[model samples]
Target: MTAPAAPEVLRHVDALAEVVGRQHVLVGEQVPARHVQDLWGSDRKGVASVVVCPGTPAEVARVLRLCAEHRQPVVVQGGMTGLVSGGVPGPEEVVLSTERLDSIGEIDPAIATVTAGAGVTLADLQDEAARHGLVVPIDLASKGSATIGGCVATNAGGVNVVGYGMTRQHVRSLQVALADGRLLELSTPLVKDNAGFDLKQLFIGSEGTLGVVTAATLALRQAPRTRTGVFCAVADVAGALELLTAIRAQLPGMLTAFEVVWADAYAVLDGLDLRLPLPMGYPVYVLAEVQGGRPEADSEALLACLASIEHVLLDSAVADTAAELAVFWQARERIPSEILRMQPLFGFDVSVSARDLQDCLERMRAELTERWPQVKLLVFGHLGDDNVHIAVVTGEQTRKRKAEVEHIVYGCVSRSSGSISAEHGIGFEKRPYLGYTRSPEEMELMRSLKALLDPAGILNRGRVLTWGNETDPA
Candidate 1:
């Protein structure tokens, strides 16, 4: 899409300023660098012409209406914590940031749900829920910076997803603003709402291409009174799966997480100055956690369960205290920071059947090793949910090599019938490989829906699925 002329862009900014007070609108140099590119840099990186902060859903709609009238493309931004660059704006596009919309509404303990604005941070919501003796099931490492709207938009799944589910499952209702400025209040706090089509789901995980998620009513549960964590060394993926099966059969709903870490890559943690819980590293590591009401009883039950699976585990460590658990978890959580220090890295979140995960990883490793023997591969993730995250470090790599590595990795994922993206949405980075995972009919249906909801295509243009690879004015 051609950018509007300088005069036309200035006029559009002036109109937006009128809708959402001039103080809330920032143009040109006033726009911050964070608004241009997401946490993971985008290839289509360009500074937005203006950054408009709307304090309310009404103000958001008003700004959308003005942009629609001006035929100006808009890129809706949340907390700017997304790794897929879904919230990144184009050079001429206007940025509608929800940061000013930060508000957490009442939490109804009776219904076990809470209403929150799209801009509310996940950490804020989690803290609020804790005060009420409730919990928001969705969680991630970036909870402090990631907004609830961004989580819903990506349908984010984190470590807790094994026990709970994705952000979509916890979302009871959504308030969305359409491309043409029309508001859609979909679903409700009611647990059993089967009135007709669940239109709210269409916007969830759509990455804001269809509409702007203004607010959400998320389901909550009573916070677990007792949390028990165990870290075990397994022989391989098969042993990891076996231990997972044993834990599930013994504890049932108690299993909260089953994180798998490949030894060779995880060995880097030893080099870090941080504390290491285990003295020796095995071939593989699995961190399993269980939560329940009775602290003492739950701890005993978890220990007994782990003992039963001794055959599958090479070594084990148990943590009931917060400090002990932190030491055990520090290794996995600190990986991203350590990997980034290496520079020129490619990160992937992929999934396959539990049985097929081992084969898929092996094939990808073989291919990558053959092509780039010097490359470093670190693999770990919430394996109980069939999700695996891989990090590749090309110590001495070029910009062009990134694509070559992606081709090798994604090719194995496709061959194994695995999803190229497990939690992260198909932003500009993954748009090309989308065809590798989705069928032709599925792709066509997605495009049809995009066309139907956003006929003018003013919202998040060139994101997810770019229509016909064509550029056109909204």
Candidate 2:
């Protein structure tokens, strides 16, 4: 592979600027520091030579075409709030940002769907849906900054995933730009379509390696009239699972979320300036929510259910008012940012079957403690979905320590037949651990797909799955 000359680089940048307007393109120092870094880790201060903000899919296609012609690698960025280093650009690469393609298009009530631009934030989409008495059920802590395209690309699963499912379930179809700059309108927001194949599913969680998702037709749910929350403490993982089963059986569609935060995680949240419903000291705590009509009655019903299981719960509190409900969720949503407050922290999100989750956690904790005597592990997440978030706070944040911790955690996950990544895609950070989750045949198939969709390997060049010596398959 011959490297592009200085003249070729200049020609590509000039062409990109012309396609997306000079004001929308940034190079070198012009790129903001925030754009240089993702949700975590050190910023790539001067890695990329150019950042292009295309307002429309047509402009995005043209930009990709130009980049392909110049043999210049392009990294696609949405909200820049990704946990993995998937969106981070290399020194020679160009960044294609979807911040300008943020338009909330048609919201068809009849079809129970909404058409939104890739750049539209999750919060914005929720607000729009609220006005029409509909909902884009997928949610996350970074909803304020996380774009629809990023969520769909990563197949994000949030607190409500136990009920509404992940971004993949909510997304009906997608409009994508292929490697050669050709556009493809995959499908529509139709409920029943016995088409030959659902091609849009490939891009939903492919992490931009397959194509650039410019717009999406997402399935919407009816906005529930009432949303009640309950913050309670359970005896152990068994009690937590029992509570989940009971709540699901009783509430049915009403139970929208079931989140579990371990004692260590509660200790972190206890320091925050918020009211703790239950006195903060429990083996495990759950933030359960129900969505239906009659908020007051729903709260009472949830309270009654808790009372019936008083034998299993150590202590509990119910939120009948909206303010109280907000406080309960506030504690859960604050986990990600507050965990960062603990210096030398490493966070992970993995999944295991409910039956094996407890053993997996115990093995992980015991092994981690034996390895790092002074380490602190804060565990929490949507337990109803069998997904848990672990934050490892250790005295040493060295590269070697981090790698060892990863090995221990992912090793346990592999032993339990659990996924290394529950919702977050295996970006470059988790690429090494992919083998623990998937078989060799799976990796080869992924490579084949990458080669077929992005033959030049110019799009997100080294993300999700890296190629040989930065040029071929690893």
Candidate 3:
């Protein structure tokens, strides 16, 4: 039998064990297999032989240094809720689970900045921020399980993107630990700094290729004193778009989240009995949320905005209280969750111009419906940013079927000039389709950046880039 040649890694793990204790370290089969992958839920090509849980940046850096010394590849993991396959560990690799790093460092109410550990859950951060009377605008459905690191790593955009923007836009600074153990203390809550290269972006949406995110300084918005939500039916995406424009123009104070759901997805909601109180015969549904400091004014503005959308006979259901608002929001949140339950659906998060969105969506919907009329397609998302999440449901869970849906959807994405992956990072799942969104010249730049940062090709191999040699096996 060949014994393990983990002399160097063991030495450092032993040192780390002394500082944080041995219980956190999962070596050999003691490491849980479930921790190896993300939300995608499958056996990874690479499975980490060992998994380590580091509680702080010091420990994270210590592990990275040891991996560097022995030239072993490391995969950083958070929450294991990522739809991409980047978090899946390789057989010889070591998994650095951020489970132990869960901490909300501080909440600066005066400055509206949140300093939180990468391992903190989205819900935890939101709750903490609420305590300080502030809000971190990057709200995703996965808030219950998704971590701060995962959101930043993917530059996540949820329903709020129409108003607040993505995780990248909200992240003021990052605290990243590089492959060579160099701690980049970049959590400087500066609103503007044009001194040089904005290094904070190096790891945002990199899918753990360049380095692991340890902590972040996220910019926060003052918690709205009042928010008015409208669940309304639009004629179609065009009407939805028109409704948003008119509403924003007339009642800008109440335009915080403007989301649209295709009739197909709305039908799914209807089938699942998750429909809003308003009748659901429309071709599209727009869940518009308006927030302002004054509740009374916001509510009245929302009512007035609904009245102005003449093209679409908008039947609106307004959420009067916090509980009512939560119920209304659930109609949107529950769509993705319920659809996910249907045998591994192909979720395509694509973004295009608002005007082009109607044409883009119609073409894709027509193409899919014409081709695989039997296939159930659920489409809904933040129409505010022209972002759509299209989930093509196949009763079959086989890889071939999944690939077929992927090719068809991505072919349209490329043709329509839409992004291949919007909120989800171009992890292993979308690597092949990256060309649809990026040109050869642009791809070359990405490759150049990856090569420069991780010359050894050690950070999360087979992710983001289509071609790259495997890093040193741990």
Candidate 4:
């Protein structure tokens, strides 16, 4: 049970309700748990002063204005599916939910763009785009629940990043609500607008620090007539990279995704009693996809490319049918859930150069295995874009030993000149490690920009850039 809000807090809540509606304002116990918890399943839960749902950008601006005037810290939330605690509110902070901003505009086939509100899920937008023979290039495991606003905020990169690109490349323009309640229309839908600074890029991966994204015009691509994928068993990461090089050189632009899964991670399917595409003894598994106009030609090209590099691969399975392709991907996607079944686990999303990835993983694995002999490390990720996802379970107290694990993992990444956060932003979870990937001067510039746009530090306070002497919440 929660206590009642202070009179001052109630007054501000009432004012915010006026902008949206009383029904849209949820207080104390009325606020759902999902609003305060992140997908990482951390024990630390946020306490929101109030949750306000605004339907329009105008209402969002008004709400921001009121919060700014009152010096109230505001946390912007969209779908709340973030792995990091970027959307999670702090104690007594105002949570501005974008769930009501769910409107999807008409798809412009001429320009191959679609404008959608912040609350629209990625899966919804993808389906709507498919209706018009177009496709949203960005695809994530959380697409069914992750909003476009969240995607733009994180500059999300998914399986198809090798084919298309990150969400940053797909977003053409953005409508942002600043901390001071000003609605800034950042860009036009023009294909090549080079007249001035492209301000929308700032907020794309800003992680809601500078401003709250209300809507965006996303660039879409024509739907491919045929898609074919192959699941291959590689000897090791180096072999997988070699196979990737061969595919790229042979298949050219037809390659859509190149994902790698470690043998330990793939073995999770056996624990789940799920069907396995191949035996589990291989060191690594690769899931590669290619899209083209002709189904037979695309399939033949992919098979031929694999055959050319058959020495590098231990075994392989081809998914020419939609059902087979889903089954292959299902094995890849289910790795996280099966690994997470352990009592205590720490997940990481980092990026390293293709040349350094194998070495970096080897060093990390050696150190972790030496320190904790009983540790389980499940590793997989987008090989094409240099991103890797690692789940570690050491059969020890994870909460207390998290820093040690992070040190081992991030130290290797830093030494390799890789990003601590590949796609996920520097939320509360990774705030301490921002220095590993960014230099003092680079971080200072980020702070300067944050101060300039959000002088009051009211929007997503203590995220990305920490506040003075502020520490992580218990």
Candidate 5:
């Protein structure tokens, strides 16, 4: 049971209530478990003195001002669908949730843009854009629950990243509440604005440490007339890369997705009792997709491209209809959840150049298996963009040996000159390993910016960078 808020905490809550309203301020038991824990069901949870739901950018600024005055740390949360513990609040901290800012403005078809509150889900924004015969190019498996604010905050990259780019490319402008309670508006709808520095980029992937995103004006693309998806059983990782190169050369910009699933990951589908779209014996599986104006011609072109690389493929399945496409994609999306179900699962998202990806994985697997012979490593991801998701599990107490596993994984990444985090921001979970990717000079520059934007270090205090370190510029 949660203890009652102390008198001082209640006073702080009352001050916060003045900004959002008493009903929107939640304390103690009123705060739901979902607000404090990671949505992926990680054991790392946190405690918030209060959870405030602000309905507007103005309200958000006011709440931040109050928290800033009280020297109270504030954590910003959106859909809570992040795999990292970025949104999880800390003890005695205040949680400023964007849930109530769920408003969508008129879709400007002429400018190919739409303004939406940070609380708006990606799926809702996509639907609204679709109604206008347009689309938000950023796509993710958690679209139904992931909010626009969170996506912008993390600069989320999904399957479409190969063609359309990441969330940073889609974001036109951002309305953010700074740590000092100031509202910074950068809502310019122009396609090219070079008048000054692009300041909105600062908060795009800051993960709420710099400020709280209240709303965004996002760029959209015209809806394609048709989308074709294909699932292929590749001979190996090399063949998968070869096939991807051919598809990109043949289909060009039409190729939106090139996801690769290792045989070990594909086998997990069978364990979950899910129907396998393709046989599980192949060394690697690829889910390729293309969207174009001409349905028939585009489908034929895609099929022809796959046929041209017949020697690299063992077998293939094409999705002629939308229903079949969804079924084919379902197998790829189900890997994360199925792997999470395993006890003491250690999940990692890392990136390397396409040339070194196979070798990096091979070395990491060898090292991990040498330490623990029974370890299972399931790997898959957006091979088109040089990113991969690795899930590891051993029959023993794997959680206790997490550090050892991370060392093996990140060491290989460091040796390969790769990033410790690919799409996921360095939340507290990956905070310690950030050095594996960033240099001392780069880290110092990051701290300087953090101190400049949030001098008090009250916004996401112990996140990406440690709080109150000896080298802290603040």
Candidate 6:
């Protein structure tokens, strides 16, 4: 509740303004609170001593150098759509928004490569790729708002994970600028590079703790010639997984996405503004999609895969229209959007092995039901990647229900050795439960690396590597 010492903070702002110009160095009450935190609810919002927006990587390096001289703790923010609180700023900190650094570089047709700055939103890149008759398979729900840098940093996975892997799998090379003003230009197009070591891989999912990701060369896929979307019903999580395995075996490369939703999730959407095209009666449902290089041939193969899956109870009213595809996606999106709309829900973006998913879900669901009989337990996820999003609804007015559920749910997640976070990077929300998925040795190694890269423990201050001082290793 105390304000920073004015003299030192004002002097740092003055120095930052000198380097990036007064216009780029934002301070005073002019700074909007939007720069404070990311998507998850946390009170980490703080007015930065200065907000430095650089125009290029070189400018970014210079700003970083100046801040390093000031020894000011810095936070990096992109589209600010992350689920964790990693991007949040603290009092007396400086925020570097990649907002003004948008640029599109070369697009090589022979290799399907495109170079873009970190500030480029996923939507803009997709549009540019569409002009070249190509597509980037890595798609996230936050594509409209998330930046390319943030996606690469988080290694995000979207609905298409059944076919195309996570963002880290798609990026060929990365261009990073270290905290001390060193530029690492790693824009390699060669597929097979057995260099001394694979350095680019280090920064892929470090959540900007190691270095600032300025630009990247990404691999693009040839646009799929045809795609099919199916909305089907299954009895339980096991049935859903069985159908997914069967469909994958039948269609092979044709299978794209296999998303499962609990029937109770529909309760969250009811009376809420969220609307769905699928009728709400089944205990569980799936949204499956298939895309192939050949249009007509792929469509035939997809239909065959759908028919071969024996667990499908009833598959009728299949809509082939785009309007129908929109309807299906709307249902999946509604669950998350409604969670944010309805109330403060204790949520998890955890992942267990594909084989362990059913067991974990059953145990978690039964445990939650017993504790809060009237509670609405909603679950939906990208089944292909073995990642799920579980929302246990508790009214915002009562913190006790939320705390009790968080304790029980995370305990199960830990016991399964499932990751506390999947696509969403580990921000502050899951910090306490990190030991559930990681071994003490693994956690120690992470802290050691944190010390090496961020000796001052400044970059992304309290995220990903919290076990160092804040948490006790079991």
lDDT (Cα atoms) of all candidates against the true structure:
0.84, 0.83, 0.77, 0.88, 0.87, 0.76
Worst 10 residues of 3 by lDDT: 1-10
Residue-level lDDT tens digits of model 2 in 1-474 = 122223435557777878988999876667776666786663233255578999999999998888887678888999878777788776677889999889998777777788899999999999999888898898888889999999988998888898888888888789999978999998777777768888999899999999999999898988888888788898799999989988887777788899999998888777668777778678999999999987567777887778777888888878878899898888878777778878677888899998899999889989988978888889998889989989887777564567788888999999999999998787777887888989989989999999999888888877878675743212
Tens-place lDDT per residue, model 4, 1-474, is: 544555556668768878999999999889877887886576557766688999899999999999999888889998777777888776668889999899999887878999999999999999999999999999988888899999999999999999999998888899999999999999888888997889999899999999999999999999999988999997887898888898889988988899999888888788566677887788989999889898678888888888898889899999979889888888888877777787688899999998998899889989999989988888999989999998888878757888889999999999999999999888888988898999989989999999999898988888888886785431
TM-score of 2: 0.95
Residues 1-474 of candidate 5: C-alpha lDDT, one tens digit per residue: 554555555678778888899999999888887798778866577876689999889999998888888888888898888777988877667888999999999987888999999999999999999999999999999899899999999999998999899899988889999989899887486788876899999999999999989999999999999998889998778898899889989988898999999988888788656657797788889999899999789999988998899888899999999989988888899988888878788888999988899899999989998988998989999999999999888668748878888889999989999998989888878888888899989988998999998998889888888888523221
Candidates 2 and 5 compared: the better one by lDDT is: 5
lDDT of 6: 0.76
TM-score of each: 0.96, 0.95, 0.91, 0.97, 0.97, 0.93
Better of 2 and 6 by lDDT: 2
RMSD of 2: 3.0
RMSD of each: 2.8, 3.0, 3.7, 1.7, 2.1, 2.5
Query: Which of the two candidates, 2 or 6, achieves a greater TM-score against the reference?
Result: 2
What is the alpha-carbon RMSD of candidate 6 to the true structure? 2.5
lDDT for model 1 comes to: 0.84
Q: What is the lDDT of candidate 3?
A: 0.77
Give a tens-digit lDDT track for model 6, residues 362-416.
7887887787666666788988888988887753456555557766787787778
